[model samples]
Target: MKKPIILFVASIFLLFNKVYAQDKFTLEQCVSYALEHNLNIKQAKYTQAISEVNYSQSKLNLAPTVNANISQYNNFGRSVNQVTYAYSNNTTNNLNYGAGANWEIFGGLQRLNQLKQTKFTLMADQTYVEKIKQDVSLNVVNQFLLTMFGEEQVNNLTNQLKVSQEQLAIAKKKADVGTITEADYLQFKAQVANDETNLTSAQNQLEIASLELKQLLNLEPQQTFGIIRPSDAAMVEASKSAYEAVYVYNEALKINPSIKVAEYQSLASERAVSVAKGAFYPSLNLSANVGSYYSWNYYLPVDPANPNGPDYRPTFKDQYNTFLGKSINLSLNIPIFNGLQSRNSVKKAKISYENTKASEVLAKNQLNKTIAQSVADLKAAEKKYASAQISFESLKKAYEFSQKRFDVGLINSLDLNIAKTNYSKAESEALQAKYDMVFKSKVIDYYLGKPLTL
Candidate 1:
């Protein structure tokens, strides 16, 4: 019984460790994983692939179309024989085989223009995929930073709770000895309880933040996850950097996928207009056909002396060879008026092209506006973080002094608790400002087409 109990306990311990073990990832690894596994990115890539196929098919359309057909027919009751070109009273079987090819020599360059349009469309979709990747990477960065911030908050609160518990222990001893009043002792007890509640809340928030990051990564909920934290110095250094909106916008326009997507779409729409206009010009097509047929009822002409004798049907190969025909024809189609369809198509295409051009301009303008706003926000965040740091340091020193005075009976529990509260608020604000600054800096880096790190 004892041995069985020991084995069961050992198994439980191993299971606990397995369940709680964390899978740690750096920022680069998280982004890489999301890119590979994110459903949005996968869907975008699928669209890109479809565009590639369309482009390939458009290129293939420039080639001629070829088709082959074969038919067998049985006729009765004085039907006309196709091979003999005569009426046959007897039941007969006829077989036919043919192959034909048609090549468009010119259709006002419609096919060529369509090919160009699909090529441009394909390029646009490819760029769109890259744009989606950038978007996903930014989202990952946001969630990752939030999770890190939450962890810091939890840590800060936990330390505060420990300090409060220590003070409560001293207060309890002093109260029992009649050195501290009941109200003062109760204040210390309340402070400890308050800290405990705040710490619990912070831990819950950290869990929520981690959960969001895990969802973004498409990880299983049961899977423990952790991030590799960057150094404080690195984050502070990054926050100090400055960016000019004009410079960042210029850099963004050079590599921004969204702008490229719009530009390509505009080019594709322009080609569409050309394709539609091509319908107004005459089209030329060249077609070639080869065919032969044999009929079972077909017979050689009767001999004059043996008219009533047995009739001889021609052999299949002989008839096929003798009846084989080949023809090639060139056809020109002048586009006569047809309910103004061609004209209407051209007009619609032009309208669509104009819309695309407008969209391209809109994309550029939006990018510029966003860059300017991001630069301003980053500057503000830096200032906020700097001020928060100073405030946190001052309150921290004041809190330590209050604690020393309280221990020596120079101050009461309320004074010490107030100082602690102020310090906690400043610490929380500092953490918020620091992470906010870091995130804003990363946004600027994104516009500059730099790899997201830390």
Candidate 2:
């Protein structure tokens, strides 16, 4: 029996160890995982790849092209041949084989312009993906901090409940000794009930927060995760200026992914104008080819008896020859007129370029506005947090004094309960303000291209 008990205990210990061994996701880990698996990041990467391919194709367009061709023809019955003037009634065959190369020495630098535009576009695409990553990281950070706050609030509420229980026990003892009135005991009981209700609400909030975090992680409903809380009394030290020191507005205009993409668009549009202008200039090419040909014919006259020596006896012929040569030819293509197509294309491209320029300007303006607003909100959250911290500190001291007074019978249960309730409210509000500050700060960092890490 002792051996069986030992085995069972060992098995239980091993199972607990296994459960704890599951990997824990830090903020960095979460962000990295999301970057690797997120749908938006994947799509952005694909778009970048397409841009790279387009750019490569533009460069390849300048390279030479080689081609080969073979053709054969047979003619029968009374035909005068080029090499020999004779009426042929049998059959004649001709075969030709050739190889050629065509290369454009120049296209008015259109290929160069296209390649440059594509490169810029690819860079923009890369930045855009980074921007999406920053956004996803921000979301993860917010949800992680929010979940932490909820957990802390729940713990605070639990502590408050414990204090209430202690006070209720003291009240019962005092009432039994005739030191406290029944009304005082009843008040303590009411306080305990209120604390219990608050605890339940906090628990519900924690559950919701957990579910939300799980959703963001794309995890199973039953999965359990943990978040690292910021260091103790962070609210006390988190000042307004320090929290808003992130260079969001300037970076948003300079480094924002959307802004970068807009700039790339403007470059691409400018290249389009160059491409249109290229049509006005001449194009040059160097080309070459090599091949061999063979032909065979057997002929009989149509007028047999009256004409050529008893219908020219059927003749069997065979010939084989091979020749190879190479030549370099420089060709120039000049565009004289195309019904003003090139001119109209240039006009359209110029218009599109202007539109892209305007869009880039708009993007910068919007980015600035977003950053400014986020900064303002962060500053406001800092102020609110400071006030909440002060309120919490005062209420905590008051609660302690009230408890001491009640212990000495200098304060009624009703007054002590009031102090406890006030302290709880202050703590909740402080936690809320602290979390709000964290959320807003993350948004600012995201815009600034400085996403939070572990």
Candidate 2 lDDT tens digits, 1-454: 8999999999999888667545566777777777777777788899989988988888787788889999887777777553365676767776667789998889888888878878877888888888777777787887777777778888988888897898789789989999999999999899889889988987887888777666666666676666656564553344234433335566567777788889888988888899889889999888887765555543456576656554442322222222344577888899999899999999999999999999998988787777777788888998898899999999999999998998898988888888888998999999999888877766766776674752
Q: With candidate 2 superimposed using the best TM-score fit, by how many Å does residue 164's alpha carbon deviate from the native?
A: 5.4
Please list all clashing residue pairs in model 1, or write none if there are none. none
Candidate 1, residues 72-155, lDDT tens digits: the string is 998878888786677868788889988999999999999999999999999999999999999999999999999899989999
RMSD for each of the candidates: 5.0, 7.7
Provide the clash count, candidate 2: 3
Measured against the true structure, the TM-scores of the candidates, in listed sequence, are 0.89, 0.71
C-alpha lDDT values of all predictions:
0.92, 0.78
